[model samples]
Target chain A: MIRITTPLTDDVIKSLKAGDSVLLTGYVYTARDAAHKRLVELIKAGKELPFDIKGQIIYYVGPTPAKEGQPIGSAGPTTSYRMDPYTPALLDKGLKGMIGKGKRSGEVIESIKKNCAVYFAAIGGAAALTAKCVKESTLIAYEDLGAEAIRRLYVEDLPLVVVIDSEGNNYYEIGQREYLSSLK
Target chain B: MREIHVNEIINAVRDLCIEANYYLNEDIKNAFLKSRDEESFKLAKDIMDILIKNAEIAKNENMPMCQDTGMTVVFLEVGQDVHIVGGNLNDAINEGVRRGYIEGYLRKSVVKDPIDRENTKDNTPAVIWTNIIPGDKLKITVVPKGFGSENMSQIKMLKPADGVEGVKDFVLKVVKEAGPNPCPPIIVGVGIGGTFELSAYLAKKALLRPIDKRNENPFYAKLEEELLNLINGLGIGPQGFGGRTTALAVNIETFATHIAGLPVAVNISCHATRHAEKVL
Candidate 1:
């Protein structure tokens, strides 16, 4: 497995490939359907974003509320496709990486390739295990959105797979084909 | 007739909600272990291990297995001989959901309006289905359905000419299109032979069955096994990273249909498929 930190650069992204397992450390921003809509709206309106989009990863999740003495509740990636309509805009703004599950639109894949960004897939439904990697979580914007609110999280050794790399190699296609052919 | 108080229903629903979210059912856990051992791909096996461990953590910590605590779906089998007193039945069920989501620290995922899109905050107004039964008992089953899987579900209306092959094709198409989205290895609940709405309901209800249990009818049970094998052959694997375990099971429930119609609904559920039951 490859070990990588946040603020992914062109060189780091280029080195990664589809089907590579990754251990992601450092900070990632939490955003889901509501937060993505707002972020895109701000960009479209020529307004300042809640946080800098450069050199950052966005995890599509709306986590359960943290219990007493817990940093966060069961935290894991939500489906990524729901954010597809707004992803290209974020990618254009120098967003370095995305962490979520599921396929992305062709448009988003093109943007990922053009912007030299990568898409990571954390194990979907592995929320309790995922939460253990979260060191800290601080709300950044859109507090009224509740679980959909943007939170900056410090994650350590969070396991992820490179589902789509900067060159636009997609693991979903390649992995499935390889497995199916192996059986034949 | 036996008298049943609304308070009992409320409290039972509340407890069931918490229990369902916090505890991963034994059937699912065993399925994961069995799949993990049988999975051919190393990464797929590892993914299964993570799922198994996640369930363990959720149970031990008394936290939800997944963050999407889901919209509460309550199935009520109310006895025809019982009289419910003291409050409205729907209100009691909603109250149970409200308390469970709030007190259990679960996420409130319901919105007041689908179009207007405002959070209900307390996860009220659960999607409830009630059926009248013969006994004096009431059976409450709470299935907190995560939208990650729910969104991937589909329904199709085929002509009677489409037959079984048509049903198989439609199910495969849905699973293929769903890809990695619904968090495979998914459990496929298929409802066939009913009208449009009834088919959809039966599909969802099929999910409530234990993964290990086959359909009671010999024909449908065989069809279930066949579809399951075909799905596993798709190579979606765990999380769609590709392997032999795309689907853990395929459950089909059928009902009488009109002569000209064959409506099918495929309700895809993630491996974290959760539900709890209580009888009062």
Candidate 2:
């Protein structure tokens, strides 16, 4: 597995390819459908965003409330496609990576290529295991959104697979097709 | 006549929500263990192993098995002889959901309105289904349904001419299209017959059944076996990496329908199919 950190540089994203396994560390910002919509609205309105988007990775997640002395609870990626509408705009702003489960739309994939970004898949239904990777988390924006609020997270060696890379190659398509064909 | 206090219902549901989210149903855990052993694809087996380990961590640590603790779905089999007291039945259930979500620290996923889109914050107003039965006992089953697989579920309104083949083909199509989205391996819940809405309800209810149990109807039992085999053959595998275990089971529930329409609803639940039940 390749080791990478957040605030990914364009060169680092370009070096990755579909199907490469990654262990992502450092930091990522958490947001989901509601937060993404609001972020896009802020951009359109020419207001300053809550954080710097340059070379940052946004994880599509809405974590549960943390118990006493815990940074976060059951932090895992949500479905990615729900954020598809606002993704191209985020990519245009230099967002280099996205961590979530499931497929991205054709338009979003095109943005990944044009913007030198990558989409990573964290294993779905493995939240407890994934939570082990999150060493620290704090609410950063839209706290009224509750779980949907944007949070900054510090991660260590979080397991992931490159689903779609800067070149626009998709592992979900190629991997499943090859595996299904092999069975025949 | 028997009576149940609303407070009791609230407390029971509160505890049910917590228990269901933390504990992987024994049958589902066993299924994962069995699939891990049976899978041929190394990646698929690896995913299964992770799921098994995740369940253990959730149980031991008192954490939700998945981050999407899910909207609570309460299925109530209330005895006709029992009267609920102290408050409105629905409100009491919602109160239970409120306390459960807050106390358990589960994610509050409910939106106030689909378009307006504000967090309800308490995860109240569970999707409750009530059935009147013949005993003095009330049975409450709480299933916390994560939406990743829920969004992938489908419903079909088939003409009488479509028949069984149509149902089978449509199911396969849904599974094929869902491919990687539902976080396979998944449990396939098929609701056959009934009107449009009832069919969907039956399909959702079918998911609550134990994976090892087969339908009493011989024909449907055979169909379940056939569909399970066909789904696994598709090689969607665990987490859609491809293997011999695309689905853990196919469960079908049927009800009488009108002459003109045959509705089939398929509700898919992912590996974290967390459900708990209690009788009061």
Candidate 3:
């Protein structure tokens, strides 16, 4: 598995390919449907975003509340499609990586290629296991959104698979098709 | 008539929510182990191992197995001959959900309004279904339903003439279209017959059954086996990475319906299929 650190650069993203397993470390931010909508709205209104999007990764997750002495609760990826409408805008802002599960839209894939970004998927239901990889968590913005609030996480060796690369290759299609053909 | 205090119901539901979220059911755990053994795809086997390990950590550490601790669904069977003293029924259930979520550190996922979209803060107003039964005991089964799989669930109203073939085709189509989105290695709950709404209800209810069990009807049981095979053939293995165990189980539950309409619903559940039951 390839190990990639956060605050990803174009060189780092362009080197990856779809279907490559990855261990992501460094800083990643959390956002789901609610926070994405607000972020897009801020961009439209010419208001400053809560955090910088340039050279950063946003995980589509709404984690359970952390227990006392724990950094975060069972934190894992949510489905990515719900954030599709707002993704291209964020990608345009120099966002370099996304972490979530499921397929992205054709439009989002095009934006990924155009902006030299990558998409990675953490195991969807492996929340407890994923939480073990998170080293620290801090709430960033949109506190009223509760679980949907933006939280910054410092992670170490969080297991992920490159689902879509900057070159526009897609793993969901490639992985399933190849595996099915091999069986035949 | 036996007097069962509302607090008993409240406490039971509270414990059910906490227990269900923290502990992966034994049937599901065994199903994963069996799938791991039978799985030919190396990647799928690895994914299964991660899930099995996740369950162990959750139980041992008292953490939610998945981050989406889900909206609480209470399938309540209240005894007709018993008296519920001190409080109303629905409030007690919501109170239980509130306490359970707060105490257990489960995520409060429910929003107050669909359009306005504000978090209710305490995951109250659970999706409750109550039935009056003959006995003097209250049976509550709490299923913590995460929306990742719930969003992929589908329902169809087929013409009566379509028959079994139509049902079979629709079921396959839903699972196929869902592909990886519902997190494959899913539990498919099929509800056939009844009205459109009732069909959906039966589909969710079917998920409560253990994966190893099948419909009592021999014909339905055969259909379940057949569907399971076809789903596995789709190559949408664990986490949609591809493998032999696309689905852990296909559970079907049926009720009589209108002569003109054959309603069917498929409720897809992720591998973290969690539910706990208690009798008070």
Q: Going through the candidates in order, what is the number of backbone clashes in each?
A: 0, 1, 0
lDDT of 2 by residue, A37-69 (tens): 899999999899999988899998888788999
Candidate 3 residue-wise lDDT, B1-280, digit = tens: 9998889888988899999999999999999999999888777888899999999999899999999999999999988998999899899999999999999999999989999877898888799999999999989999999999999999999998899999999999999888888777899999999999999999999999999999999999999999999998888888888787889999999999997999999999998789999988
lDDT of prediction 3: 0.92
Q: DockQ: which candidate is best?
A: 1
For model 1, residues B216-241, the per-residue Cα lDDT tens digits are 99999999999999999999999999
DockQ computed for model 1 against the true two-chain complex using alpha carbons: 0.91
Ranking by lDDT: 1, 3, 2
Candidate 2 vs candidate 3: the DockQ winner is: 3
Please identify model 2 stretches exceeding 4 Å from their true place: none
Candidate 3 backbone collisions, by pair? none
Clash pairs, model 1 backbone: none
Most lDDT-accurate candidate: 1
